[model samples]
Target: MTKRDNASQSKQFSIYLRSTNEWIPVTKEQYKEHSKFYGSFRKKKQDHCKCTCPHQKWWFCNADCETCKYRTGGDTVSFDFMYFNAETAGITPLEFLESNVNDFTIDVDNKLISIEIIHYIQDVAPFILSVASMRLKGLTDTEIAKKLGMPRTTLLARVNKTADLIREKFPDYNV
Candidate 1:
C-alpha cells in the first residue's frame, strides 16, 4: 500500500486500554494484536478484516469487548481534556473553554495577570452537593481515585481540598 493509504488506515481506528486509561490510534502492526485472537476462530479462507470483530464488527466482540466480565468494571468513560484543565485551575471544562484566552489591561498598571482556564472551569462547573451528580457526570471520586490510582477516601479528600481552595479563591463562588 502507498504511504498515504497506510497513514489513513492507521488513524481510522483507536485502541482504548482500560488498565492505563489511554486511547491510542491504531495501526496495521497493532491490528495484529486483534488478529491473534480472532484468527483462531476464523475459517482458513477468511482474511483479517473479513472476520467479525476485526473488519466486519469493528472492535465489538461478545467475548472480549462485550461479554467480557470486566467490561462494566473497566474505566471506559472518555476523560474530557477540559476536566484536566479545570482540575488544574479548580474549575470545569465548559468554563475553561468559554473563558477569555487573554486577560489584558492597558489602563490599569499595565501589568499582565494571566488568568488560567481552570479558574473559569471551576466558576462555570462548580462542585455539586450530591455524589450521585458527580457519578452521573463521570467525575466520581472512585473513578478519579482509580484514574489516579489512589484510595477513594484519599481522592475525595483531595477533591474536597481542591474545592476548598476554589472556594477560598472565589468567595462568592461556593464550591
Candidate 2:
C-alpha cells in the first residue's frame, strides 16, 4: 500500500449515535475530545447537565483532586466509547462484547477484573483491595496478616468475603 493508503487505513472511522440517529464522522481518537466536550454538557435523565454546579467557584479548601468535589468526571453517560469505537472500526457487536479490556487478573487461579467489580469493591470492600494486591505480590495469608497487622483468620475472612462478592457479581466466572 502507498504511504497515503497506509495512513488512511490506520485512521478511525465515524460512529453511529443511537440517541440522535446520526453518524459521528470522527475517528475514535478525535471522539475522545468530542465525547468529553459533549459528555460534560450532556443532559442527564433529569434533563440537567452534571456541571450545573459552578465548578469554577470553589466552595471550600482544595487540597488536590482526591479531595476536590469540583473535579469533573468524563462523559460516561452520554457516549458508549467501546461500542462506538468497535462500530466505527467495522467490528460486529458480538465481537466487541467478546473482546472486553476492562478486566484485571489478580492471579492465575482467580482472574478477577471488571469495572463494576473494581468500583463496588473499592466503594464497599476497600480492605479487599489491600488483601488482593498483597496476595498478588506473592504474599501468603499469614505474611499478609502480619504485614497488615491483622489476625490471619481476619485476613482469610476478608479474602473469603471478597471471593463471595466476586461470585455474587459474576456467577458464570469461577472465582
Please list the C-alpha lDDT of all candidates, in the order they appear.
Answer: 0.51, 0.60
Candidate 2: minimum summed lDDT over ten consecutive residues — where?
Answer: 55-64
Best by TM-score: 2
Error of 2 at 29 (Å): 45
Candidate 2 structure quality by residue, lDDT tens digits, 1-175: 7999999778866655544556667876776765555444432411432233343332222223334444455343423343446345755555555555323223422533566678878977798888889888999899989998999999888878788878988797655
Candidate 1 local lDDT, 1-175, one digit each (tens) = 9999878755665665545556667776776776566455443213322333335543434234344332342222333533445346655554554553333233232222214325444564444234435577778677756766778987677567766766776575333
Total backbone clashes of model 1? 4
